[model samples]
Structures are given as structure tokens and as C-alpha cells.
Target: MTTRSSPLPARLKSLLLLSCFLGGIGLMHAENWPRFRGPSGQGLSTEKRLPLHWSATSNVVWKVAIPGEGWSSPIVWGKRVFVTTVTDQSTRCRVLCLDRDSGELIWDRTVFEIVPLRKESKNSYATPTPVTDGKRVYAVFGDGSMAALDFKGGVVWTNREISFYSRHGLGASPVLHDGLLIMPFDGSNRVLKAGIWPNTSDEERLGWQIPWDKAFIVAVDARTGRRIWTASRGKSRIAHVTPNIHGTGRKAELISPAGDVIQGFDLRTGERLWTAYSQGEGVTPSFAMGEGLVFTASGFEKTTIRTLRLGGRGDVTSTHVAWEQRRGVPSQPSLLYLAPHLHSVTDGGVAHCYQAASGEVIYAERVGGNYSASPVAGAGHIYFLSENGETVVIRQGAEFSVVARNAIQEKTQASMAVSNGRLFIRTAGNLYCIGSKH
Candidate 1:
């Protein structure tokens, strides 16, 4: 006769359920700040208890000096931190990996070397931030050179098919989706002479001021670095805006913005799906998307915040535009969309909060300092890092309220990264990991 097993004890069952419930909480808070603007690529963080007040000395878990020069922000994966820099007079491109906990250097490897391209004094040769898939780190330099390195500093693959040229240099980072690494080459055909600020005439600024058909977005196989497809922007000028994916699965769209055009492309096949004319050149701020709407800043010329409703075909300039705001559009920093509220700080130090659905300005105030690093949100606080390395922290609400103003008193241009309840800040000379000591 077969014997029947006894049921688990009531106490044991209760213990098991409680253990699972706690495990769920741990998983929820264990998100990585993987890319340029964290995992979402839109400067949003879900981890709580992030450091609210940190200076050069206080609350700093660890600090280390980074070699070379780069404006590329630190990207975190698991226990490793990855960042790229160009040394040897911006010719030697190097990628550095550090331990996430104690801020120790794990490995530093030079991926490749290239002749330095012309860039603005404020921009670096390694301006584009690196992206990782938890397996390998992918980086792109100013000359359209891409490299992938494994966690152990092993070079995986490199691609240098496109000869990228831009008057202001490349600043847009690559995004990884479905085993493909996609990057936009919205560069101009003309390269400005060294130390030249303004062009002599309109004829000398064909690619920068006038639209060109050679600008394209290319996708490569993540594993092999083989070209997957190239999507042309038709006729568009230069822009530094990075592309973000909208939706998921087969219906997803790659939302790409150039100087004068914001277009949607089929993520899988690289086909242009829709377009919206945004007149401007040298567009820097990456767009933000939420609630079935895409928000972008029309760069340079007539700087304005334009919101477009999703799901449109061909030219959606007139049909899909939901609202437009002209008061406080940021030219450098990207937009932060937090539910019903949108937050942005202009390069001139003016911060504004707006209603996400209506384009109504809730508050317009000056927090101080010139801002280039994009603002990051966590623990219901928005942290806006300025060029002078001062972070103006504000609470997320209808009324503009300052929470804390923290300063490291250094030169900083790269955006901040958050992960595991800690903030990774990259200044001109050092990388600081900020967290509570307790």
C-alpha cells in the first residue's frame, strides 16, 4: 500500500510566504542605471532612499580619479561600472571598468585609436555614453567607431563602417534593443576649422544650416557587430538627440529626432514610419515619451517645446501636434516626465514645471547655475546638475518647492547615474559614488 505524505505545518507555510514577499521587495528595488539616462533612457529612477544632500566630502561612499577626458556618464551593470574616455590627445579611446561597491578599478583597456575629430570646446571626443546588456558594454566615439567589450575587459567586436563628420561633434549615445545596437549619425558633411565659431556665409554652412539627405541611423548586430540596416532621415540637418524606443514587441517604433525633423522608424526593419518637422539645428536634448505622447525641444532657431500624440503616419506636423510651449524650453538638458508633471531646466538656469497633458506652465523659477547635465528623479525628488557641479534638488509637485541644494564645487557636464540607492556622479577630474554611510 502506498503511504500518503503529511501536509506542511502552518508555521512553515507562513514562513515560506513571508520569505517570498520580502524577496519581491528586494527585486523591485534592484534596478540598474544601465545607460545614458538610466534604464528607461529618460532620466527616471525607481530606487528609493537616494542621497538627498551630498558634497565633495560628506556622504561620499568612495571617490576615484579617472584618467583621460570624457563627458560620457558612468553606466552601471550588476557590480560593475563602465565608462569611456579618450586619452593621448583624444586619439586613444579607452574604456574603464570599476567595482561598483568599493570604487576600485577592475580593468582599463584601450579599444582603438583614431584621429581626433573636430568638436566644440565644451564637448568631448567620448561624449556619447556607453550602453550595456548585462553581458557586454557597447561604446561609440566621435568618429563613428563602435566597440563592444566583455565584463572582463575582453574586446568583443568593433565596427567602423561609417565615416562620421559633424561640425559640433557626436553626442548621441547608442541604444540596444532585441540583440541590435542602434545609433544615429545625424552629422553634417562639413567639418568646421579648428577654433572657428561662426561660418563666414550661408553657402559655407550647407550641412549645418541646410538640410542634407546623407544623415542616417544604423543598426548593428550586438553579438557580431555586423550591419543590420540603415534608416535614412531623408532631408535633415545636424542633431545630437539620442533615439528611444516606444512601445514593445512587433509594434514598437524608434523615435528619432534630427535638427529639423522628428521621425518614427520601424525598429526591426529601419523604415521611416512618420515625420514631424521641428525647425532647428544642433538639437541636443533627447526627447521624453509618456502617456501616448512624445515631447521634444525644437533646438537653436526658435526654441519651443512641442508635444506630439503617438500613432501617426507620414508628416504629422499639423495632425499630431497636441500642444506647444515657448517659455522655458531647455537647449541642453533632456526633459523629465513624471506622471502628470514635466520638469526641465534651461541652459541659462531657469527651471519650469508643466502639466504633461495640457502644456500649462505650473511654475517658472530660477534654481541657479548653468545646466548641461540632465536632471534625474528618484525618491520623489528631481536632481538637476549644473555645469558648476551644483545639484538643485526639488520635490515633485504642482508648486515648485526646493528640497535641497547640494554642491561638489567642481566642473561637471556629464549627467548623473543612479543605481542600488546610490548616485554615481562624474566630475571633471573624479568619479564620486554618493550614499549614506550607515
Candidate 2:
């Protein structure tokens, strides 16, 4: 006798399809590091089995010498790794793609070229990291030139609407959200007869020490590179902060910070939603949001860690600030808020942990290195990379307990990227992939 089987119920079939769709999403998240600090623009990785111990030779799956100079971090999408560099005497801004597993150059394309502007000694002509949406890679050069390229190294489009000029150059990387590419050009005045280095006089320090009104934030369509909208920051000093998105859906806001101010804008229209006054110039650290609170460091002058409550319209400086702590403020590295505790490391290498809710200090200990790269967390540990190529790993908690210290003994300024259980560290001249070969 032949037996017949009944088909699944309609509701059961719907549920099965949803499960497969969500599983595909989770797999995508585990395999890609598509932007500056990973998929979120905040240095947090979900990949497990990341290498905890690596050196110049040990635990290194592959190492390739990159051409030219760029402090921009490497970004990964699937089997490809992307990074930007400026070669030919800082006149040619180029993008390079490499094989993620084999460390071989897949393609190299020059996005644009320009007469490089005078930047800070530590800054580079290609300091802004590129962002990828799995199909195309978007990069912004120091001169405010932006371009989008396909996976095969063909240029799709380029935009040069803004001629960017910053005493510190372009350090803020562009961020991609909901088919829009957002970038901030918080720069100084175009003409300053006092030259590159400002003097003590306020006249000579027009844009460096004092704020200017030329600063603006822009958003462009990711696919066509067409200008969508531009929001003006009336008067603000130069900054190198990459913006991050907060909340979701219609209520979503872009949290962007420049010197002397931090503001939120509607993600779709670039409408200024709120503003908070922060002091000092040349701000570099980006915002860290969690538990409906935003954490950022005040740049230069008197540095401090300021925490603000989310949601408030117009100037919320007086109404939304929850607390301000002047200790352990980082001038370069971005703040890392890991659940109940907020973690920060100063440029001088002193690490501090604080209660995220009350802003109370839990512990402050010296880690011993000058840091330029921001801290990243994964596999139950926080990795802080220093300018001198030392990584101090500490367990995630209120206590100041260090897990391990790994060193490659090379000069490193770019933040590390984690993907598929490997750490991509960009030193001065080479990119090292750290993971077990097995």
C-alpha cells in the first residue's frame, strides 16, 4: 500500500520561512565588518573564537605590506577586505581590496586626487575609513571628495560639492544608513593668513581656537551619490568625529558631535532635532549610546566625559545632561559603554571604569601606552590598541582586571577590525590578520 503525507499548516509554513530569514541575517552579521568600528560604528563584535593572543608571527594567519600611508582602519565584507590610502606624494587617493583569507591584492583603484591640505602631524591624507554596503564601497578623501565604487573596482559615482579644509584634515569616516551616506565637514575658515600652525593671538587662531560658521553635515543617496540634504551647524570648531545613529524607525536620530557641540538630527531629512553645548576644539571621540543615555568626551582645553539623557528638542544643554565627570577623559579614543559600566582610556593610557547609570567611578588604573585607536570589545574582553602597537586586553566588568597584553612591536594608529573570528590590525606599513590557521 502507498502512504501519503499531509502538507504543513499555513501558520507553520510562515514561521519556518521567518526562521530561515532571521538565520540568514545572523550569519551575515557574524561574517562582516563593513565600517570604521564594525557594523555598528561602535566597536563591538559578535564573533566568537577571536584570537586572544597574537604577535608579530604567532597566531597571525596572514600579513601583507600595504602601499603608501593611511591611518584608516580596514573594513571587511564577505571574503574581501577594503582600505584607503594616499600615494604619489599624497596626491592620489586610492582604495584597495584584498582577499580576506589569503592576504592577496584583489584590486586597487584611485578614487580621486588633490593637492593635499596641511593637516596635523599625526593625521593622514586618507584618514577617513571607507564604508561598504556589501555591493559597493564608499570613500571620502581629505578634500571632501566622496566616491562610490563597485566590488569589481569600477567607479559608480563621485561627489565634490564641498571643498573640505580642516587644520586636522578629514578624520571622521562616512557612515551608511538606510541607503544614505552621511558625512560631517566640521572645518575651519578657508582663509587664515597666520598659516597652518596657529599662534597665541585670537586673530591668528580664527578657526582653530575659535569657532566658525562654515561647518555643515551632509547626506547623499548611497546608490547615485546625489546630494539629499545638508544641515548647518551655525558656528562650531573643527572636529574629527564619525556620527552614529540612535533609536530606530521614525524616531531614529543621527548623533553627530563637533567641537563645542553635540547635536541630533532626523535621519531621513537632516533636520536638527536637538543640541547640547560641549566645550573645546578638535574633538575626535564619537558618541557611545546605551540605556537611553549618550556618552562623549569633551575635546582639548579641559577634557571631560559628559553623559546626556536621550530625547529633548532644541537646546537641551541645561535640561538633558545627566552627569559630567572630568576624570579619565580621552582626547583621541572614543568612549566604550559596555552595559552597566562605561569604559574609557586616556591618551596617556589610564583606563577608567564607571557605573553607566550614576557616573560613579569604579576603578582607575594605568595601562601604560599612548592611545590613538579606540577600544573594541568581543569574546568577553576589551582590546585597547596604543599608538606604539601594544594591545592591552581586559575582562569586561566593574573591576580593573587585565586579561592579557599582546604586542606586534610596530607603529599602529588605526583601530582594529574583527570579522569571522579574526583580528585585522593595520600598522604603519602592513595589515596583519590574527587568527588560528585551523
Candidate 3:
């Protein structure tokens, strides 16, 4: 006869199990600002009441000087904030960890000094933003060197996989999923001029064909820097843009913007899931994902915006695409959707509103100045920061209405990060945190 122990109260057992599950889910969302546009790479913050207006002298909690020259945005986990900056020489790569509340520099580490690398005039060595998993922060340099640092500023591992030429440098920020750090390498080895009579030799016309420069995404273990898997993109230049993970009923798909195509890969196995061809190159913008559809705006000769449904196999180019919008799409900044409508500003500063579900144009208005930073949305308002130090705050709706056109004294090319009911903008000269006191 087996003597079984009496079970605890049924209600108490169920309550304890539910509490543990909820706690795990909460912790999962805590350490995740993971990519170019925050969680999910959507540029939408569920963080409520993020401050709208900020200036150098007003609503500033703290301001700290970031050394070096990098346009990458900041990522935060718990009380620690992480940002990458270039050293004074522009040849050394630096990563700084800051206290989120006090804006104090906790630890500063210079990781690499690039000796030989080719980058476009507009790009820099530290343009790629760092990604963190709460325990480790991963920084990728333009020379194809990626290093993972512990929370206490200790180096875990570093890997220099491939070396190639970047026409505009390394602007593609890394993204994290589970235990993997995903990075994209897209480079072209040739530069062509239109005229000069078309009689130039194939070598003169095309330059050195960099057969090694192919578009591919690699996923490495965040803890050990080991390559978990890599998916090749076959002779393409995919730069600047980051990847977004979308749900496809069965599993999550890692969606990325390769040159002239928006491709999806298996998040678990690094398998090619699907591809949607578009009329774009140098794809730098992140996608807005929701309601079973992913919206992407192409860059640099990207005249159209496309919406593709998630979860398709092979070449779902024809069957998965929902709709495409062709007017005033952005070439640099990423797109933002306020649920029912999509909002974006072109490089020349044309603010556009489109129906998110149907891809219909609602309104088009000029906002002025040139823009490269991804716009931030908060407090029912959309914020557009131009390259000329102009901040345009607009009401989020079908009608294109400007709420406030504010300006700063300095130039800003980096996107603003919102946290703890405050807005942090990193400009060319300084970093400003804006918010009102309680």
C-alpha cells in the first residue's frame, strides 16, 4: 500500500503557480530595448507619459558629455544605460555605461582602434547601436569586430569575423533574441560614375569585385560569442537596417530589409523563410509590426512603402504582401504607426499620414529641413527631429496637424529614447534628458 502525501490547498497551489508565471513574463520584458527602434523594433513605447517638449535649460534632469562621434542611440536595462561613442581620434571605438537616473558615467571602455577600413563620408565607425540582454552588452564595430561585455564592464568575448568596405560605414545596429546576438553585414566593393563616355574597361567601370562582400545575417551566442547559425543573402548590400521578429502562428520569424528585398529567416535555425522584393537599396529603417502584418519603408531610392503579412514559406513574395504605398515614403527615417494610421517624414521633411490597414494616403504636409533620425512617438504625439536641430511635434491622427515646432541650438542625428516618463535626445554636441518634475 503506497502512502501518498496529502496535496496542499488547491486554491493556494494554483495561486502560487500563476504568480511564478506572471513574474517570469514581467522579467522578460524588463531587459529588452534590444535594437534600433526599441522593443520589437517598432519605435512605439508602451512606456506611458514620456515627456514631449525638452530644451537645454528646461526640464533637464541631468546632462552628460558623450565622448567620440557616433550616431547610434542608447539602450537601457534596469538602472544602467548603454551607449557607444567614437573616441576623439575617430579611429577608436568606445562604449560607456551610465546610471539611468543620475546621468553619471559608471564605466567607460575603449574596445577597438581600427587601423584600416573604408567607410562612406556620411557614415562612422560607431554608427551601430549596442544591444543588451540585461546581463551583457554587445557592441559591433565597422571592421567586423563584435564584443560582448558584462554588466560590470568586463569583456566576455570578442569576434572579428569578416573585413569588408562600407560605403557608408557600419550603421546596422545589432539585435538580440533569446541567447543570440544577430548582426547583418552588407558591403559593396565597386563605385561607378555615370558619364566619361561608357568606354571604360570592366575593371575601371566596376572596380574590384568584392566577391567576399555578400549580405548575410549571423546569430552568435551572447555569452560565448560562438556562431549559432548564419543565413546567407547571396550577393547583396544590406546596410543600416536592423531585424524585427514577427509571429507566424507556428513560430517567430526574423524579418530584415536586405537590399531590394525584405527577407524573413527562421529565428531558431537560421533558415531562409521568405523574401519580398522592393525597389530599394541601403535599407536602413526598421519595420512596424502588428495585427499579422509588418510595415517597412525603404531607403535611398526607395520610392515605395510595403506591408507584408507574416508567416509564409519559400518565396512568399506574391502571396504575403498586403499593400504598397508609393507617395512620399521616407528614405532615411523609419515609419511609425499609431494603430489605425501610419506616420513618416521623408528625408526632405514631408510628413505623411496613411491608413495602416489599407495602405491609403490620408494627408501629406511639408515639415521642413532634412531628417535622418527615426521619429519618436509619445503622449499621443509624434516627434520629428530634423538634422538642422528642429523638433516637430504633431498630433497623431488622420489629419496632418503640427502641435509644436521647437528648435535647439545643436544638431541631432540620433533618435530620442523615452524612459521613466522622460525623453533623452543625443545631439552632435551634447546629450539632453527632458522631463518635468512631479
Per-prediction TM-score, please?
A: 0.94, 0.92, 0.86
In model 2, pairs of residues that clash are: none
User: What Cα-based lDDT does every candidate model obtain?
Assistant: 0.91, 0.90, 0.76
Q: Candidate 2's residue-wise lDDT over 1-438, tens digit each?
A: 998789999999999999999988865564689999898888989886678887898999999999999999999999999999999999999999999989999999998888878788999988999999999999999889999999999999999877787767888999999999999998876553444545557744655678888899999999999999999987888889999999888888899988888999998888899999988888998778899999989759878788999999999999999999998999999999899989999999999999999889999999999999999999899999999898999988977788889999999899999988899999999999999874
Tens digit of lDDT per residue, candidate 3, span 394-437?
88888778887777767778887776666667788667766775
lDDT, residue 390, candidate 3: 77
Clashes of 3: 2
Q: Residue 294 in model 2: shift from native, Å?
A: 0.6
For every candidate in turn, the CA RMSD to the true structure comes to 4.3, 4.4, 7.8
**Stretches of candidate 2 above 4 Å error?**
1-29, 192-203
Q: 237, model 1: CA deviation in Å?
A: 1.3
Which candidate would rank higher by TM-score, 1 or 3?
1
Q: How accurate is candidate 1 locally (lDDT)?
A: 0.91
* TM-score, prediction 2: 0.92
lDDT of 2 at 93: 92
Residue 301 lDDT (model 2)? 87
Candidate numbers, best lDDT first, in rank order: 1, 2, 3
